[model samples]
Target chain A: MIDSIQIRDFRGIRWGEVDGFKQLNLLVGPNNSGKSTLLEAIYLGCTAGQPAHWEGDSFEPAQVSLSGRDFLGDLPLLRVLKRHRYHLRKAGQGPYRDGCLNISISSPAAPLRRFQLHVPDLPILPDSLRDMDSKISRIEIDEGAQVALFACASGRDAGRAERALAGRILQLLSPTQGAGSTRQKTVQSGHKTPSGPNKQRRTAQRGARPSSGTAGPGQQTAIPRRPPAAQHCIYLWYPDLTYHSAGVAAWSLTGKLASPEHVLFFDVSNTHYHFYKTFLRDTMTRVPGWTYKIADCLREVLGIARSFDFHVQFLPAKDNDSLIQGWIAPRDQPALPIDAYGDGTRTALKILASLLSLVEQATADSPAVLLWEEPELFQNPRMLNRLLREIARLIEGKPLQLFMTTHSLEVVACVAMLVREGLLPADSLRAFRFSLEEGTLRSSWFHADNLLSWLERGMDPRIWDTLGVPLQFTLKEQEEGAE
Target chain B: MSAAMGGSIDAFYEGMTEKKILHMLMQRGLLAKVNLCDGKETGKTEVNRRLRDVVGPNVGTKQVRCLVLRDLDERETMERIKQGLQTALQALYRERGHPKAVVRFVRHRAHGNVYLHTCTELDVRVALHIATYRHLPDFCKSTIDDYVLRVALHHETAAALIKRQGWSISSKRIIHKVTSEIPALLKQNGIPMMGEAKDFIHFYAALLRVHTSPAVFAEKILHHAPESELREVFAPLRAAAEFLQDASSPSMPGDRLPA
Candidate 1:
């Protein structure tokens, strides 16, 4: 579990640091305050060297960003995300330029298990997309040297960026061969000795200069950057996609980011909502046993009295493919199509199922992470309360850490109440408030103690910054005004 | 927000009464147009925490002028104001994350006031204005009711509110208590002056005996309190408001307050 997270110049956040994550980390703030962006940064940080997005079919709007064939590398993503960024010219000053973005996530329990991603605000990705390779990500626990992220515009660029990353990985792990990065094809390669002094000197030298075009937190110390023959670097990440084990073979990642939590960012942004069906279809095919568990979770959280069996049915397609259909078949009752249920149900199912799967696959060594955004979406207060309790229950004693974001202060209160009731661990809920300005996105993290205190004293911890001020919401025509 | 973004001032007050009162002053152009965020009565620590919370959104943008109106639940005097709240202010920014931060109460030749100002490490200019709400500035430390009574009882609107129904203060007993009983009560307490923070406590106690709802009574007085009276009695709030409006350094109240 990533107990702490720090991001500087990632999306709308110029500089933000929030720690004290429990099993459930709550990101609470107003709109445009960079709560969602914080989640995205964690997701990207943990999954460094992995493709940040997969656009799938251009025509298919429902196609999720992290899946399918059309993967987008750093340059392409920069193209998509460049406009949302600004240049923090000074400390808490200046318009957000396309400056470098860095994200560092660490587990306090496992201090060495850290993942840092730094994408240098390269001048190259802004205009021309066809030529650049996004070998920019450096994940040195901190370089990735955390994300030396290079940019590539399309799938065509992905292939090139992938090889460049693999070659850089080869150079970092094996200095003898890394010295040959200018000539050697680092793909399909085996392990070599880790040269501590050589790597340390190079890393420190690179780390010496902070956000310059030439220097950074040196992670992969020896990769000759932007080589002419970028294509001949290596082809390694493709085979490593399924390589989700604790043992990281080769990549910008050296020891792996946190024994490597199977980091999954469950984003519910309007465009990315289509993945629930895809998730259900895959789960039914691979782990049909999870159906009953998911059903039980859904039933208990939704306060449904009756038992049900969550299932996905297959039908013959016009092109001889099996068209998958999902259903919620209640025990001793007629089967109902999953489509008949509301988005809240599906969203819960997605979360519950993912939790179950991750928990089942997780071990003491490698815990799983679920980066859930907007858990309150379409959820009534009662349902939300139940769902939160259910989540706490599901992850109890299990190796699963949930980092979820919600615009609802109700969620913070609910979690506090849960901790109060002993349904959730008292120390395991960290509520962070993100307040955004021009060159800064400030994060204030609250422990259970603060939450309980705020609630007890009639303070709304969610808007702590505006608590003593007369904002529109706090400014009310109440009986207290007479005082 | 840089130069492109407009500036903003937000005041963090202890209770809804202070909020409505400040907002009332803002509406009357007696104070700056401040975003008044009401605080829970968790005391001094909560005030400092809330100030810390507002620092971030302004750290990298156009600096947001902050005015903290925490009712430390005590009466203020010029000696205490002059001694400076640097220790308290220093405690606020001394947390681990605030790097090389320094807090200084604005050095001033101004009178004994309830307000203090300091810049945090992030350079968030925050001014802390003490909300002195007491039954008697010398006697009992109390709620925002004291602030209401202190400012409003001096205004002619207090008599109007006494006569108004459902707005509290109904009978001749209450009117006598406000106009006659309160003065006699203060005299009974061996008090020589009327303007101390303690004096409001006596008036509030009299109104309390009449079953006057503090919130309702405060609202009526704030709404109907004359411009001149507010400018005079609420000069501290107005000072902080004006400080918020200006781009220059923060200034303390030049006017004196009874210890």
Candidate 2:
């Protein structure tokens, strides 16, 4: 576990640090408060450690390589990732400070491992990647096929923007998370960078920009080199579209990852229908009678009196696409397609299945990581609380690190209530609200008692600014007509 | 609401009484938010625990402040505690064969105002108030009820409430005199027919021969009081509000806390 994390000049966060770590960390706040960005930085910091490697043989011609401690770090902008400046003084901020992207993390594995990379602020490349000059044209044909496929699914515009800057696609392939493979211990989505070396790691020292004119201004200017001791080629599931009814994430990570110590960020691009089917199929192969357990979980969360038979049916769609759909119904009743059920059930059932998968595969040596963006998506307040309680019960004793974000009052209230009722261990839960103005980012943690105090009294600590318990401050007596 | 990345003031009023009083006393523009203190829990441990909830692990890093409002109860309660302790000690001494015959009584002085800048050890500024009846005894500091009494007696809101409740006054003249000189009567000369309770609402209920809980009656009296009259005695609250406006940084204790 990353016991402590300090981020400096990483995207929106100028300087911030979370001193403590908990098993179930809830990063919460208003939208764009660096909640997601903080997760990305942690992913990058943890995966960008020393002795890292990337295989661009998947691409051609201009084979790009970058793993030198003294590699001249440029502001290489990736069309896939959101970009921001290192120093831009906004209103009320004091002054601009000079710094680069640096995330220093301290864990039992690494006492003081510093992950530093500053993509120098680069100007926009002149020509779109598809219409790039011959020097850059040789790369776009197969520029990170995986990146382009998902980048497009992420949204229409992101895909277009990515192709326009195909020259920098190799940089995105660096897999900015969980470096020094052996130290990572846990696998995300069953994708493993087999443990090798932890010793051959070095920081990227600043070297002046190359003085070659082979690539003009606003064109590809990356210095390629051979790969180093390959380590931590981890996958980071962009948490952007993890909402309900979305397609499966482009990472074919839903394969047989029945291994413990897996870190899965569920950003299903498809509505988790087929993704969970394959995932559950994998889990069932390893753990028999898992279907019955999943049925119990679904029954518990749905709050239905009758038992449910949780099963997936393989059905062919009109377009001839094979759609593996779940068919859950009250026992003894005709099965109904999962599409007939509310999206709430679909989402809750999906998350519960995913969690059960991780819990069954968990190992004592390594605690699996489950990063859920918003567990309250499509959940009714009553069912959401029950779902969270089931979630709380499932992961209680398991060696799993659950990091989730939410804007739901029910989620906040449920955690506090569960903690108070002794259902959720108070120590295991750590929540913080983030605020980032311009480049200066700030964070405030909500202690267990704080959540109980604010929430138990009907105060929404997620939106903690509102005045609590409006008072009756009457002035003069009521008017003559008033009762 | 979105602009304030910094924390707002966490006004830890003692209970609903103090919370209601503070809400009406301090203007909304100056006052950010008010929180009810833990249910009557006392001691240094509870204070630290309470402060930690607002000031999480991000102590010095986060700009958060809280005005912890607890009443400075009457000196009589302290005397009662001492008497009780003395009685307990005597019983133990009698059983253990120790001397208890020459027990001398000592009356400690009452606390005027307690100002603790505990923001260092504790993460935020803590302000404790003593409700000052400006014309009352010099060393007197009663519970928030006393201040509620001051606001209640203002323009005789309590008197009007008494009349509206339709309870018979034990002595018509005392009710008439109470509507104006209630604080002086509460301080120097106790009200006629009203018992020894420090809060005027109890005294008024007693004099009026009304049978209702003080908590219920206090709520009634506060609600009946004019907003204009309540603002008259809200000086200390205004000062506290101004102090809490820039709560991001813990500053020196406000000079006129109990104005």
Best candidate according to TM-score? 2
lDDT of 2 by residue, B82-131 (tens): 34334433342332233433322332112233333333322334444444
Tens digits of per-residue lDDT, candidate 1, A1-483, equal 554543433445444555556777888877878787666555444433222311111111010011111011122223223223321111111122222222211111111111111122222321112212233222201211212232111112223333334333334333232211223332221112222221211011111111112111212344433222121111111111102211122222111122222556564432122333334455556565786777777888878646444453323322223233346776577776555778777677666766776666666566566778788888888898888888888788877677778877678778889888998887777777767765355666666766765555455656634445543322333553333
TM-score for the A chain of candidate 1:
0.54
Question: Model 1's DockQ?
Answer: 0.14
State each model's CA lDDT, in order: 0.48, 0.45
Name the lDDT of candidate 1. 0.48
Clashes of 2: 19
What's the TM for chain B in candidate 2?
0.56
lDDT of 1 by residue, B143-252 (tens): 45565665565536555555554555444555456656767777899976564443454465456444545445465667777777777666666666565566654344
Place model 2 in a CAPRI quality band.
incorrect
Writing each residue's lDDT as its tens digit, candidate 2 over A1-483 gives 444444433344443445355777888877877776656544333322222221121221111112111001111112213222111111111111121122222222221122222222212232332231243343433212112011111111112222222223222222231122223221111112222233212222111111111211212433122122111112222223211211111111100111112555543222343432334456768766765677788888888646445454434432223234556755577777666877888887667766777777776554466667788788788998898999999998887777788877668778888899998888888887776665445666776876765553444556435535462212222112110
Show the lowest summed lDDT stretch of 10 residues, model 1 chain B.
B250-259
